[model samples]
Target: MGIDTFKEKCGYEIDEMWLPRVTAITSILNKPNLYRYFADSPNYPAAQRRLDSAAEWGTLTHEVVERMLKGEIVKPDAKIIPSIKAFQKWRENNIMRISDPEKDVERLVVDTKHMFAGTLDVVAEVNGTRGVIDLKTSTGIWEEHYLQTAAYLSAYNKTARLKEKCTTRWILRIDQYEECLGCKAKRRGKEGVLRVTGGKRICNHQWSEKKGVVEFKELEGYKEDIKAFLAAKELWEWYNKKFIRRIPNYAKN
Candidate 1:
């Protein structure tokens, strides 16, 4: 989304007031890796296009997986079939259950005291541990992802009943890539852009079958993460104070 659109959608309407979004708040932090990515790119416009396309692709994948989790049979796009298959395999292999599909899947949560809101991916139990499961289609999980999930978990627990409170948070990354047979370099082809990572620069370059990778990682230290998130929220508000001031229903606190 563009800057203006993002600013407008940074919050959710509640009782005629707008509460800031968790993701939007966390987005204020600096990312050195992202800066390097842009610096290494041939040009800013091309890099932006690739990033936009990848975001769309990721959203499509999220929608398909969410629908499937809701017990709706879904045929994912041909490009994302591998990732979906990996997710299905993981689901079958693990003792995981979506507590309440209707309410737990893409659950909308709000922290009234903090005045923030977000739609979390899943409220689930994996291997007997109940927690928030955040789905990601990024190449790698970053610290900001932990902050995002931490914010969701905190907000969710605030309003949840005793038994419904989450004990922890997790990031479930679903991605597909092809590895070179000779050099073992992995190539990710998302949104029609092929990017290679690791291995020798010059090689015979025989690529293996495209395979999906699912990584489930538990994020710790929610106490600190949420603190960081709130700090970021403060910074975000300061950066957008002018625009935010124009929002009629926005709660500046």
Candidate 2:
């Protein structure tokens, strides 16, 4: 897709909240010579194909972002053009700016060994304090979104070269564009809300690092739930690397 098309249609910007997982997964999946480990597995070919597709998608997405930020207009390929147009209309109506678009930032850091690391999309000063901002394209918000943001914060605390602490993290939801015809109703609707199809709110979140907490104002038990999620992610990673890697020929069954 064209970068301008994606940015204008999506109507949101990337943030630090997405860095941790993206960084971690990208690092693991893109690790130098790491695919060799899967060479003997039955799923190697399919896995490699999937990985290749993912890499292409990642590269395309990055290119789109760069083009958009540079104020260049991009033309999407035929397959994605219709959707892109629809998204453009939706974003034009509901686009919300979470921070100043004019800021100089550094690149994101991704680390694999620590089971956490990734580059954040945007890090800027919010009200005189540094904060992380993430952009997401989804039909609706998921609970894990908060955990993902928190994980990014944790990673930033560990590896960001900046001397200042990232005291805030945010998730900005860019609703998918929905198009319908033959009715008096609006032809296009919000993407994020369209996913829920209910009265649920789809907006942005600001997580405070100093408080040592992340909050989802819409959900009552958000804080406790996030803590549990982080713990589970840690355990799952450990099991996959330390335990699952040791299993022999179990996949052949």
* Top candidate (lDDT): 1
Q: Which residue pairs show backbone clashes in model 2?
A: 15-133, 15-134, 16-133, 23-118, 108-119, 175-191, 175-192, 176-191, 176-192
lDDT of 2 at 227: 64
- List the candidate 1 regions with Cα displacement exceeding 4 Å: 1-7
> Model 2 segments beyond 4 Å from truth?
1-63, 70-107, 110-115, 126-129, 161-163, 179-226, 241-253
Query: Candidate 1's residue-wise lDDT over 1-253, tens digit each?
Result: 4546855678787878888888888878777667755765689987787777788889988999999999999988898999999999988889988878999999999887777899999999899999999999988889899889988988899899998888999999999999999899999887457888888998988888899989999998999998888888889889888777777888765
lDDT of 2 by residue, 116-137 (tens): 3445665555445565655443
Against the reference, the lDDT scores of all candidates come to: 0.87, 0.42
